[model samples]
Each structure stands twice: as C-alpha cells, then as structure tokens.
Target: MPTTVLVAGFRGSMGQKATAMIKRDPELELAAVYSPHLETTDPAAYDLPATTQVFNQLSAMDTPAQVWVDFSTPAGAFENAQFALEHGMTPIIGTSGLSDDQVAQLTKLAKEQHQAGLLVPNFGLSAVLLMQFAKQAAQYFPDAEIIEMHHADKKDSPSGTAVNTAKMIAAGRKQAPETVENPVETIPGARGANYEDVPIHAVRLPGYVAHEQVLFGGPGEALTIRQDSFDRESFMHGLNIAIKQVNRLKGFAVGLENVL
Candidate 1:
C-alpha cells in the first residue's frame, strides 16, 4: 500500500508542487490537504484529486494520512507539526522560519510522541551540497560569510538555509575565527545578520528564485561555494529523498542533508 500524505498549505507554491509530486509517485498517496486561511474545503476548488480530503481547520483534520507534508508559513508550521505528531503522523516541514528554540521544542515533542519527522531548510540538492562543502571548508578556513538571495515573495529574511549553513560551519570549526572590527561605521547594519559568529547577507529580487553563496577567507585567498535554484523543479529531488526517508528520522530533525 502507498504511504498516505497530508499536505498542509496546499494553496502555496511549494505545497502545490509537493502535491503534484505525490500524485505522480506510485508509493505515495495524497490522502488530504490543509490550508487554514482558505475557506473552500472542496478539493476540486484547488485542482486536487476528488478523492483527497480538504481541511481548513486543524481541529477538523482527522484523516488517515500517515505523513504530514508542510510548506506553510513560519507562524503556522509549529502548530501544524505538533498537530501531525499528536495525531500520530510524521511531519515533513519545508518552511524555513522556525528558530532554534522552536525546533528544539518540536524535536522534544516528536520524541515524546515517538514520531519521526523532518524540518528541511532547503530542498535543493545544490544547496544541500553547498552547506556540506561550506562545513568542510570551515574546518580549514574558519572565517566565512554567507549571502542568500531569494525571490521578492519570500517572507523570511536571511533564509533558513543561510542560518543553517552558519550553524553547520560553526559545528565543524576547530576554533572561533576572529573577525576584523570596523573602527568607524559608515553604516550601522552593513555587516548583515550574525549566526554563530558568521555574517549572513540577504537579498530579495524579482528575478531570483533561490541562490546562496558561502565565502571563506584565509590569509592568502578566499573560496566561494555557490548554489542556485532557478526553478522549483530543482527542489523536488531532495524533497522526494526526504519523503522516502521520513520514517528513518530521529524525532524532528532539520536539513535534507540529514536524509541525504
């Protein structure tokens, strides 16, 4: 039998893409869809399968879905994941606004419920590889900066990928690398956001889909690792990998790299 899936935020771009992928996959079943902000509960309204159940309220979501695939907003992600776990469904979260504390809370909840779930920062293989390569380089370089670019529609700044990359690099570093302090500040916030001592710059533009660069500077030269997602198709492969490996997760884990 195919694994049943409940796609939260079914009206969103990533959610729609996930729904299509699930339908195309023989091993996965689109049992239900949830979009709290949408009033229409008819699957046909969203161009979803007629047999698929539609839900607008969390309290009313009692379906046979074994997996909860979420691409909802940061505001709704935590509640959705908790609901999935409380109802004995694994959550595959693709949303990127969750803080470290929120992730920790969800991880604890997943363990208490004995459920395996994932919170992925980026579902693009190139992005995942970039993070890995950056972590590896951090050991030798130790000093680095991150720049993430996304579409103007993206709600979160700095992105989950950039923050994750910083944390990953921090974990791999042998020692804390000292940064050159600017004695005179021409601009107060010119250095960008800091995560684990690494600076992250965020850029939002109309033409961009998703792109990121990890720059490592040493005494002699600097290294740059870059990844680009020109289209949504770039993420599907890693998302598929995450879906197939969901049950193998240890509680609520972050990154598609965990499954990779």
Candidate 2:
C-alpha cells in the first residue's frame, strides 16, 4: 500500500505544491487535508478531489495517516507536528522559526514514539548547497557575515536559513574567535545582529521572494556564495524529496542535507 500523507495547510502555496507532487509520485497518496479556516462541509473546495476528506481540526481526522506535511506558520507548526506525532504519524515540517528548545522537545517525542520527524529550515537545493559551501569556507575565513532577503510579509526578521547557516559554520569552526571590537560612529546598528559571532543582516522588500548571500573574508581574498528562489515552485522538488524520505528516517533530522 502507498504511504498515506496528510497536509496541514493544504490551501497555501507550499502545501498545494506538495499535494500535487505527492499525487504524482507513485509511493505516496494524499490521504487527507486540514486547514483551520476550511469549512467542514467543503474542505476539498480548493482543487483537491471531492472524495478527499477535509478536516478543520486535527481531532476530526479519524483515519490513520502515515505522514503529516506542515507548510504552515511558525506559530502553528509545533502544535500541528505534535498532534501528528502523538497520533503515531510522522511529521515533515517545512515551516521555520522553531526554537532550539522546541526542537529538542520534538526530538525527544519522536525518539520516545520511535517515529520519524523532519524539520527543514529551507527546502531549496541551492540554499542547502550554499550552506554547505559556507561551512567549508568558515574554517579558512573565520570571519564571515550573512545577508538574507525575503518578501516584506515574512514575519521572522532573521530567516531560519540564515540562523541555521550561522550555527553550522559555528559548529564547523575549531574555536570561537574574538570579533573585531572597533566601534564605528558612522551609523548605529550598522553591523546587524550577531549569531555566535557571525553577523547576520535581514532584508525585507516587496519584490523579493527569498535570497541569501554568505561572504567570507580572509587576509587578502574574499569568497561569497549566494542563492535565490524566484518563486515558491523552487521549493517543490526538495519538499517532495523530503516527504518521500521522512518515513525512512528514524528520529528528528534538521535541514535538507540529511536526506540529500
């Protein structure tokens, strides 16, 4: 039997793309869809098959689902994921902004239940490669900064990709080095926020979709890696890959690199 998948935010762009991809894939099946705002009578009004079950609450889902895909907001992700895991379902989290403490808790739950869970900060392949390159470059440069730009409507200031990239670079380094303490009066707050000594700058603009640049500076040379997502479709392929691989994973996994 094919793996049954339930999408939490089935009406959103990411969720819709994932649903379409899951329907096309041979290994996965769209078992159900859930959205808080969806009407109980016509939950499948948004292009889904009329036979598909529409649920407004997680408790309303009676049938067993193998996997639960979350493309919802940060505020809703943890609750949605918890509901799935408690019900013996695997969770594939595509939403960002989950804290370290929350991740640890979720990891513990996944381990206790012997179920798999995945939290992907960024689901773009190019973004994952860019982070990998940054990790390698951190050792040589030791002094680097990241700039992330996204749509103005994005709630989080520092994108999850930026935070994860900084953490990865920090972990790869030998030791924490002292940052240059030169105080410049040219402009206040010019340097941006520091994530474990790695400066991070966030930009929110109307036209931007999602973009990031990591710059590493050494004695005389500098290297920069950048990735851009022009549309939501850029995330579809990676998300599909994650959905297929989530069941095979034993515990919690962060980032797309683990599956890749």
- lDDT of predicted model 2: 0.86
Residue-wise lDDT of candidate 1 within 1-260, one digit each (tens)?
99999999877888888999999999989999998888788888888889999999999878999989999999999999989999999999999999888899999999999999999999999888999999999999999999999999999998999999999999989988886776455887688988899989999999999999999999989999999999997888888888888898777788887887
lDDT of 1 at 29: 93
Model 2 is weakest, by summed lDDT over 10 consecutive residues, at 38-47
How close is every model to the real structure, measured as TM-score?
0.97, 0.93
Clashing pairs for model 1 are: none
**How much is 39 displaced in model 2, in angstroms?**
3.1
**Model 2 clash pairs?**
none
Q: Which regions of candidate 1 are displaced past 4 Å?
A: none
Compared with the true structure, model 1 gives a TM-score of 0.97
lDDT of 2 by residue, 13-126 (tens): 788888888888878788888888775547445777665677887667775678888988899999998888889888989888899999999999999988889999899999
lDDT of each: 0.90, 0.86
lDDT of 2 at 242: 85
lDDT of 2 at 56: 84
